[model samples]
Target: MVDAAQKEQLIFVTQKSLRMNRKKHFSESRCLQLFAEILTVDSGLKPAFLFDYCLSNAEQIQEYVQELQQTGLLSENLHILSMQENVLIINLNRIIQHLERALQENGVQVIDVSVHRENPQLAETWVTKQVRAQVDIIWKHLKSQVIQTGESKPGLVTASEIFSSEWNLCTMFGFLLGFPASYWFDFNTSFENCLSMTPLRAFSVSAFCPRITKNLKHRMYSFSVPDILYLDLQSAIKTWQRELQSDFQTQTMFSHLCVSTESVCLSAVML
Candidate 1:
């Protein structure tokens, strides 16, 4: 690591060249110039940008001629490089917490902003003083064992420290906020609570996230990414039978993939 006195930074990365349309992409070069502009404004926070080797544009060797023209938009104080190959870098934490703020700003519906709206005095502390204290506790418990381990590390605390403590703590906040982070934070990325009509209301009991009961993996032949496999129903019976014996719910789910008199399976070979 650099001297402890050195500033920490968020990094912006640029692809040397776009492989899909090398000539056209190299000619336009708008993406690279825009990237340099993002770094220029981050001077107060001291974020950096780095270029990788193997020369294409920088890696694809298109050329950095246009990148050089944008000198005013690049900052020397915010640039950094690392020599150690083993070092790992996280560009930036979500850096954006406070999901409800975005929803409110964008005029999207928010379930609740917290009772803090009713009492301004409780703004930073939110629901309770005790929960704020738990933030440090959770951080210690989390770091005592495993995250980016094997070295003496500094304590890591992301903004979501409030909900990270324990399940009950989050559940408490969930009811208090009228909706937890689950219902709003990037809701579209997860289909877990598909059945629970969130923000509107939720099931009183736990909502089991639905998963692919049948991705038909057996119909998949040994593979790599994007490998094509021919489906043969003959092989799917074992999986179907296994599910049929497990429980009523699973059996009901898998029943369509089976037939009593002529049970079938499927197979595939990567093409």
Candidate 2:
């Protein structure tokens, strides 16, 4: 039906069209894979839709559809429509309205309506004000109780004791790391006081017993101890002994004062 030259031209044209179609199909397949990867990392309708819109505009739909068909990756359940004159128009207004309704129903209030533009300083100020208001309410309740009672309740004493115990441990650790003898002496006094208290006695004993045993084992292994920088080992031991003696004196004074003053107060109250 055609001449030899015409036949050759027809075959060349057909091959070129096929090559172009294949290249376009590969590009679409790659774009779809990228879209899937993005969806895997972040799951949200707005983000997904934004990504899909971008891909659709960047790559032609015919090629994408052909790739989807070839790979059997087309989801029949998903209602994907081609952007044509016959199809419904999708505008930013409709998308925004839908997002607003959905977010509102889900109890998500959009404080900043602007997209991709936010004032960090204003946001920080707003957050700080909210936090301060909450803190003010807590302080108000505390102040009201303080005013009514004229003194904090006895429960605060337990909190103070816990705080002092932790502070003593920190000071002890610092003293072990080349602090002056005076600082170690102060920490030793606090530590001894903590050990004497009923609630804290068990913890102090547990901690100190393990530490002493560990140090003794290390000294036995090495047959020597590290040189003391601020205070000699002998001086440190003497300081600990002095703290113990001072604790005993404090206990004796407290007992005598309580026996004398408490009885006198009771007698006066009875009278």
| Model 1 lDDT tens row, 1-271 | 1122221111112333333354433222334333322332122111112232222332122123223223333222121112222111111211111222323333111122232232111122332333334433433433332333324233221111123323333223222222222111112242222112111111121111111222221110011111011122223323323432342243211122222231222232111
RMSD of 2: 34.3
Deviation from native of the Cα of residue 158 in model 2, angstroms: 70
After superposition, the stretches of candidate 2 with alpha carbons farther than 4 Å from their true spots are 1-32, 35-47, 51-59, 66-70, 79-108, 111-271
In model 1, the worst 10-residue window by lDDT is 220-229
Clashing residue pair totals per candidate (backbone < 3 A): 17, 0
Error of 1 at 65 (Å): 13
The lDDT values for all models are: 0.24, 0.24
Across 145-164, the per-residue lDDT of candidate 2 in tens digits comes to 33433353321210000112
